[model samples]
Target: MRHRLFEEGKATDCEEKIASLGRTPQEITQSLLNAEESLLNSLYECMRKDFELANGGGVSLPGYGTKGALALMAIYVAYKNGVGPFPKDLLDKLNEGRDSQHLRHIRREKGIRIAKHGRNEYHLEDLRLGKAFSNRHKGVEAATFAEIKAAYGYRCATCGAKEGELHHLPQYRESKEPVILHQGHMNPHEPLEAGNIIPQCQFCNRAYRNWVVFDRNGRVVGVSDWTFVLKSIRERYLRITEENRKIVQELISSLTTQLGQLGEGE
Candidate 1:
């Protein structure tokens, strides 16, 4: 099944024009998450994930954050709007001060033919965005989910919360109760597989989503470079996770106290 496109009940995608320049993705994204958001900002998170946003380490990997963001948006906008090349002005707003023509250098340096225009417009290769914003996950079998849960000891790979719900074939269910063990993909860029799947608690899944990839050993093998726009959300995720961590600590302390009381009576 295809992943859900819209957040139910709440309408996003304001289509508000981003006329102002020098706006960071974090500011724009937080603004959207907090109140109403423009179309571009509303979808930045999804776009960030699909690009496999990593540090500009290798030649092929797009530069993390702003560089990747601008390129992906170019491809997405062109294909979606039937615009021949993604417009220059739109790309500019995604990252200000850097002239849009740098996309050509980006295309050359990355060794990927993202094809920038002489006039600074850009478009994705062959008119396809592949998986950006597509949210494609080949659904996992119920038994496989059970196995994954067993493998991970039914605990969240991120923050170990013992009792939680098990979710198979991730659809990113939002919950305030934090009652889910997500079957998460190991490589942020790769598709779901038995080898790559890991169990993460709801807090880990939601908070660390799109920003970090956990190895089978539950070690952080890779991290996405932060964009100015994304840093705030990242902070928000960690802040919430910290609060939950404290709650777990309190529970442990209370349980230990009870255990001591029981020993005293004995």
Candidate 2:
């Protein structure tokens, strides 16, 4: 309430001196969570389905299977426990590393709110459906997998990594080995194997899942430009900075009666 009042320029006129009702931080967090219990519950259900689709690999979003989903779940559960979600306690413990990049993308690009908690800690303030996750695991048939592998010279069509297990190529036929190739779709909306598949490494497949689809001959048949994404983020930053500059100017003017010039006297 106080924050809203401050934003509307009515905080100074409020009769209550301090805005807080003397609630503990935990109490406040619990209150916020309680207010949106139904929404968060539904979000967890969707995440569970996405996890099944991606399985152990990434899908839709980069590093999502390895990082983002688990981190967000941890953040969700942290609020349930009435505590802040620290990176080490939640993020690294699940994925063994900090996925700050994922967090930044979701917050800045997706417009999800992440509020800062006490002293360098943070919390997922609100839950928003950012993007649709589509990934039918093993959507490619086994026989087609072999055919695609052979077509790509038993190597990654994306990065040219050998199809066989690492450090066991050239004579890997002598011993039974697991193939490390993935049949990635060039067009996700098309049929699973309607001549729209390309063999890719796990890294490349995951990296280029939702963008940069290519043909078997290493030609980019499908494109999802990331330039627009960068441009939008840059535009948002500029808008926010301009609004902040105006707010700061107003605050300064209110604090002091001096009229300031952009360039002080030639």
Q: Tens digits of per-residue lDDT for model 1 on 1-266? A: 11122224443342222212114433332333243345545455444433433222322344434555455654543443334565666565555534555555555444444766676566655421222311112222345877878766777765556545433323433333645777776777776777667777766676767676676645566665445226765777434466388876886799799999999999
Query: Over the stretch 49-162, how does candidate 2's per-residue lDDT look in tens digits?
Result: 434443443323333344565456555444433444554333444445333445544554444455655544567664434343233222233456787687668887666767
Candidate 2 regions off by >4 Å?
A: 1-143, 167-179, 225-266
Model 1 reaches what TM-score against the true structure?
0.28
Prediction 1 global C-alpha lDDT = 0.52
Q: What is the TM-score of each candidate against the true structure?
A: 0.28, 0.28
**Residue-pair clash count for candidate 2:** 0
The alpha-carbon deviation from the true structure for residue 227 of candidate 2, after best TM-score superposition, in angstroms, is: 9.2
Q: After superposition, how far is residue 90 of candidate 2 from its true place, in Å?
A: 58
Question: lDDT of all predictions, in order shown?
Answer: 0.52, 0.50
Error of 2 at 23 (Å): 89
